[model samples]
Target: MPLRLPPLPALRFFEAAGRHQSFKLAAAELNVTPSAISHGIVGLEQALGVELFVREPRGISLTASGADYLSYVSEAFSLIAIGTQRLPNHRADRPIALSCAPTFASRWLLPRLAGFRARWPNVNVSVDTSHRQVGFPVDGFDFAIRLSRAPVAGTAWTRLFGERFVPVCSPAYLETLRDGHGNADLRRATLIHVNAASEDWQAWLDATGIEGFDTTGGLRVDTIQLAFEAAGMGLGVALGRRPLVDPDLDRGALVEADPATIASTTAYWLVSAENGDRRPELADFKRWLVSEAEHLETHADASGQTVRAAVS
Candidate 1:
């Protein structure tokens, strides 16, 4: 059933008058004559069968009934404005839809996303994880994080960071390894494969000239972080990607089982479609990402180790 209510236009004038306590002030705000404001309020009060305002020689003020009604009317108008805000013409801000790999999102990006929010609180960011590369101009993604050596054609590729390969193991597991040849002793250690198409463990092993290790036997996980955690728990030696393992290594959660490391061609790239940076928020995000990447690279360069990421 329709709500039993006074006329909306009259109610608007009444609320404005009630708030200002002066028909002249309400008329000035509403761009109407003072008489119109007074007439609208009078009609509203009549429709509600209540004297909503008390007029005086000096001015006018809302009665107790009007004050009570003003609260509900003002809230209703606020709700109406809120409901209208979702309309395309009314909304000034839209969420920056970002697509990225699950591992990269969780391990690297999510941890650092707080800084972005703190800086650009008004700009909304929505992240979705997908192993598959998003189709630009069709998928509707504003930005994407692609971990690959080659950039997707026709897209702007902003290099986030380069990746390297290392075999990471828990301190407890490293303690069990033979001292003379850590790489060769890894033959006895269990391998935690990330199950990525790149086969990081094998790539690292081949780079170090280590052979005859039983690569076939080990627990396999779908993502790098899961394998990292498994390795940290002393389950097995998992292949660690750059930056992702840096945190664990620094915290002593995991250690590089082999001193040798290989700088892979693969790296994390920020991919955007043509004209994707048209939005100011997107441009800021791109700049922020580049800044973060530069800082990471600089720190890694200072330490003589390089920045690195997602296995694509």
Candidate 2:
């Protein structure tokens, strides 16, 4: 008898949902809705004639069957990625194509790219920025930097840095709020928001639990780099993550608006294809990248003594 198989699309959804342990997160990875993931998984369960998840009131958990099946599916995907990466065209001299989040590409990596180029003059690299997670090996990108509190989809998930948030603005902008303490006069100032990310003024505000100011009243930009740029130009106060703002702080172009910092559980992960370890340039890149992140201050509060200012 011929072997039975679930629909390929359903299998893919099941794998993603199982790996993340959340339909919502799985939907994010697959760029679909949670309902779609649920439907797909339901379809798969019907096809397999088994319960794959133990659905609870709050969230879903994988059944023993689902966990066992996921291990196999994940391994198969890894094997495919490894095989593709080992092809003849993936030569040592081929320029390492790195994909990254747009903000990270502009603010973090590109600024430090000169160091990498100088260290490996003979090697070449091309950087592509995307908000979506691309398929490893199939996307033709050798590596990618993912910003998340959890592991990103792919094989090698080496952590590069943990994230922390602080509000930053030009020195001139800070002067405007000199008499203002806390959210008092600061509420009237323009706010800069990175629309693509969740690390917004609202998130920072939530973490700090400082009330009264409107978190939504700000200039919204598509990327975090633009947020910093606007803040540096005194356009508004931007919630700056440590990984991207440390350079600005060091140069005196920007300063902390508040001394309090919101430490992010998510960090940057260096994700790559399954065969990334076997690649020639990966070792060099990882070593240099790790060293740079190690030097970034995760706990330093640069903004002067934090104080409560009245919402004047």
Candidate 3:
């Protein structure tokens, strides 16, 4: 007997709309018009004799029936992905294309990637150190690591870690700034700033309630990695974001100039296609990445006097 079901295209439209909770976003992802998505979903609802969404002024949300149906539809798609992956012509050796910021690619990911390789020797990752946002599948990227305050729209997001920006400098440089109280006196010290993250210094200072520290003038560099390099050379104090700076701190190449830290409003997140982790390789990578992040958080400095700052 032939399968009795809704039209495949209508199912596809319904799945995308349900996943995103917005007809507009669904249209964007599917490369169609919002009207087309709405019409398709409406047709599907009519065929099933059910209302799939609770349309509101601000947005649309899945109804109870819609939510239940979505699970089955999502599972069907996952099976399709897995089946396609297992096909004879499928290239198992193909690299998993990834996009991320250059600084993160160098200072953080590169250092830890060797372990990922060891665990999944056949699974290769091609890292694209591009700062620009990329469209998934269309851009040929399987995953992306991004720093943002919230999850990127139209993709599945797994938060890697929250960020804490701390003041760091060479031990020798720090020694030169100590006052009679044996505390690092930043008011007399040169402030190093990353041109892209000029607000870090001010955020740290505000969070610490430190007065008389001038952020108006200092060594300005293009990247956080460069700023750290300058600080390591005993140039001046730089605000180093956590996890990225964790390795340096462990190596004693840099020390916290002050005990206070600003918990940034932003964090690092791993993004992929919706339901992308259904692939066994992607699932493994996601698990490994989360575990690595958890390990870092477990061993991170607990002694720092933390102050929340909405650092961009």
lDDT against the true structure, each candidate: 0.78, 0.78, 0.82
**What lDDT score goes with residue 312 in model 3?**
47
**Candidate 1: which stretches are off by over 4 Å?**
1-91, 179-184, 306-312
RMSD, candidate 2, Å: 7.1
Report the C-alpha lDDT of model 1 over 1-312, residue by residue, as the tens digit.
Answer: 977877888987887777778888778767899999888877877778899989999988778887898888876775564445435654357688899887788778888899999999888888998454454533456789887878877778988887777888999998887666643478788988877646477677666677888887889888887898899888988877777788899889999887667777677899986666766678899999899999988877787753233223
TM-score for all models, in order of appearance = 0.66, 0.66, 0.68
User: How many pairs of residues in model 2 come into backbone collision?
Assistant: 5
lDDT of 3 by residue, 66-111 (tens): 9999988876876676567658757767788889988899878888
| lDDT tens readout by residue for model 2, 1-312 | 997767988988988888778899889877899999999999989988999999999999999988999888877776776786678765668788888887777778888889999999887888887555566654467788887777755477878876678789999898887663534256667988877785567667776777888765679888788888999999989887876788899999999887777677567988886557576687787778777776653344344434332111
Task: Tell me the spans in candidate 3 whose CA falls farther than 4 Å from its real position.
Answer: 1-88, 301-312
Q: Which stretches of candidate 2 lie over 4 Å from their true place?
A: 1-81, 87-90, 180-184, 297-312
- Whichever of 2 and 3 has more lDDT, that candidate is 3
Score residue 218 of candidate 3 by CA lDDT: 90
